[model samples]
Each structure stands twice: as C-alpha cells, then as structure tokens.
Target: MTASTVLYEPSKDGITTITINRPAVRNAVNHATSLKLAEAFQKFENDASQKVCIFTGAGTNFCAGYDLHEVAGNSTGEVAVGPVDKVNGAFGPMGPSRMQLSKPIIAAISGHAVAGGLELSLLADMRVVDTTAVFGVFCRRFGVPLIDGGTVRLPKVVGQGRALDMILTGRPVDAQEALAFGLANRVVPKGQAVEAARALARDLLGFPQKCMQADLVSAHYSAYDSPSLEDALRFEFARGALVVAEESVQGAKKFDKGAGRGGKFEKGKL
Candidate 1:
C-alpha cells in the first residue's frame, strides 16, 4: 500500500480522524488502499488515548466504493471478499467493516458514500453528512454483492423494506432523505461535515468514558447479539450495574448539587 493511501491523524483531545486519500477515483478502495485502511483503523484501536474516531475521505468525496478497475484486471477468480472471523480483527474488502470496534466512530460524509462506501459508513456509530452527500447501493447494476456487512447492517439501520428498496433499485438517496431514513444522524451545509463531526466528538469527550462505552456496547449487543428481550435486559442490567458503582453514583451526587439539572450542561461542572 502507498503511504498516502490512508491518513491517520489523532488529536490531542482524543479524537482520531482517518481519511481515505485516493480522490482520483473518488477515494475508491483498491486492494492496497483496503490494507491501508485496515492498518489505519488498527492503529486507532490500539491507542488507548483515542476515545473517538472520525472516518472520512479527502478532497470532495467520501468514497465511491472499491475500485472496479482492479476487479477488471483480475483474470483469476480471486476477489477481495472472503470468509472472516468477525470476533477477531479480520479485514473485510472494505477494510474494518467486519470488526466490532470498541470506541465510537462518526463518519463525516461529504460526497457519494455509495456501494461499498455505504457499507463503510455503516461501520460508524453515527454518520454526519453534508448537503451534497449521496448514499446508494450503486453496485447492484454491476452484479456486485454486499460482502462487507452491508446486508446485515443496512437492514438493521434502515429497516427491511427501505433497505430492500435501496438494494434492489440502486437509487441515490440524498442527504435529507438519508436523514429521514435514519441513515444519517446529522446533516450540515456543504464542506462542513468534518467540522461538524469533530464538534460532536468534543461533546462525547465530556462524558464519563466507561459509562459511555458501556452504554454503547449494550446498545450494540441488544441490536445484534441478544436472542430475546429477557436476554437483552439481563445483559444490559449486568453491564449497567458495573457502571453504577464506577460512574453513576458520582453522577447522581453531582446531580444532587445541580450539575446537569434543567437540561443545562456545563462541561466543567459535570
């Protein structure tokens, strides 16, 4: 992989911003770029100092998906998609798409986040999109399948009917529509996605880390792992019970003194 294929920048305040740099093909992931992307996310995961991640693309676009040129050149039937152990840190065709990351990730989408790009965005806990951002299953026309958690995650994100419509039709869903679909958490003006995501990260930083992470894991487990309502409640209670002694007691004490009352949040006071 080229050195510039992916850029990993970690801020002093615990935010890691990972950018795909191949804008020539709208930041498409070639095999080499995919390796770089996997490595970049690995680096972020290893760093205990980093609390949040902002995944984005350089130039105007987020990513156009995998580079079909590489696929066109392959005479052998070998492809980027393969069997992976999702519990371990296995690289997907779109890099970190298969792994369950510990920290929160926010995707700052500026342009087309389509096909595999759309799958990549699904890896994020939240997507902060700009006015120009476009999302779709653009590879349907090319007979390409969603190999990197797209089928599983898309249905979970936008529900079965909406996901099937996008998957079958390959129609572009604009930013406003994506917001309505719950595909996007926040939408901003053009050229402001990254800044908006960074600002959101700052807010996340103010919260107690362990409590936030525990809640995040619980939510994900309930969404994807829990077999029944009883099991989900049991798991949530077990996880949250640990945080009560660690963080909730202190938080409650602060609330008693009016730290976060009346919906007023002061970072230092909290």
Candidate 2:
C-alpha cells in the first residue's frame, strides 16, 4: 500500500471516517501506516467542523495488528513505533492509541480485530461490530507484547477477570460474545459495521457541541486522570461550568420550547 494505507475522509455533516486501507495484509499497520494513522486522527481533532470520527479498515478485516513482517525485518533493537515519553505526547505502536480525544470516535469492526487491532479498537469510545468480527490478544502466541494502551484500557473496558482471560489465553471472542462482555457497543449485519457507526456518529453530531465535548473530556478525566473521587468531581464541575453559559442556557431554552419532550429524538434536533 502507498501513503493511502490510511484514508481520511471528512464529511460536511461533521463526521470524519478514517480507514486503514491495507486490506491485502488485513490492514496490518506498519511503521508508515502507523504514522499516517496518527496524522489522520490529529487532523480530525484539529478540524472544529468535524464532530465525530468513525475509524474502520478497508475490505473485510478491521486490522490484524502491527505488521509483523516489518518487525521481522528489524535486526536492530530499535522501536518500530514512534517516539514515546512519559508525557501525554506518547505514541503507541498502533498510532493514535495514546490519544485521549476530546471528541467521540466509533470503531467499525467487520473481521479480525486481534492483537494490535484489538488495542486499536479500544481507542474508540464505542465499537460497532458485525457478525464476522473477532477480538483477541492474538499477539500473545507470537511472544509480542502489547505496548499500546491495551493493558490499561482493556481492564477498564471488560473488567479484570475478562481482560486477564484474553491476555492469558489469546482466544478468539466472536461478535456476540464480545457484545455480552460489553466490548462491542452494537452488532450489525455482516457488512454493515461502517453504516451503523455512521448512524451512531450522526446521533452524536446532533447534540450541543460544547456541552457534549465538556462532558466527554470530563468523563476521560474521571476514568484515567483523577487521583481520587473528589478530584474527579471537582474536575467535572469545573469543566462543565465553562460550558453552561455557552451551551446549557440555550439548550434549556430549547427544551422549554418543547424540544426533546415525550422521549422523542431526531437527528440534528439540538
């Protein structure tokens, strides 16, 4: 694959879909592809008009993992992944895995999302999978360690027992099982993962932008950054307070005018 190994598509309706385009290798990410993936995500974050991002891969599989062929070629003890430091600037082997995006991202998983691919899916706020999708720590059998956010995020996502099971066994968890484990937010038909993810993104795009982003940031802070419950609450309050005047007042006025009543919902209503 060329530089197009990563495809970045931004729609006018505030949805950016980033695709891993190396289908020939089941979208296995190599060094160049990893850099492109990181760049695409940064672009999406920088574009204020893009409210939601749908991350998927080309053809069938979502991703196999970091391209082991590339790793095989590395005779030196050099890191195939980009620079890593103790700060927030760290980059994972799967690229954007380290990013704590302010906006929402949905992963559209169709086929094998194992090893680093599983880690990549964890980067999304939600995963929309199809019947063919599979999740696992496949790299465990190859003696490859997960240097991405996999170890940190998997436990938070699926609990300690389940995370340990996947980490220890490297077994394939099908779409249905993943849904039962709360790993997959939605399961669609065999080929509709991306479409389902797009619909989900549309729903998110309809919300009050500032208020939604503030809540998103606060949730991440509470989940990963806050040292204690008190700190989390204080951070949440502080972040939310900044959005009240900007979005909350107008949203309340709209609500008073009979919007979002009777449990009704429509795209772009807000």
Q: Could you say which candidate leads in TM-score?
A: 2
| Residue pairs in collision within model 1 | none
Give the Å shift of residue 25 in candidate 1.
0.8
Tell me how far candidate 1 lies from the true structure as C-alpha RMSD in angstroms.
2.2
lDDT of each: 0.90, 0.91
Model 2: CA > 4 A from native: 1-3, 77-79, 85-89, 268-270
Clash count list over all predictions = 0, 0
Question: Each candidate's root-mean-square deviation in Å?
Answer: 2.2, 1.9
lDDT of 2 by residue, 1-270 (tens): 335899999999999999999999999999878878988999999999999999999999999999999888886625455544523556777888898999999999999999999999999999999999999999999889888888999998999999999999999999999999999999999999999999998888878888889998999999889999999999999999998998889988988999888777787564
TM-score of each: 0.94, 0.95
Q: How big is the positional error of residue 235 in model 1, measured in Å on the Cα after superposition?
A: 1.4
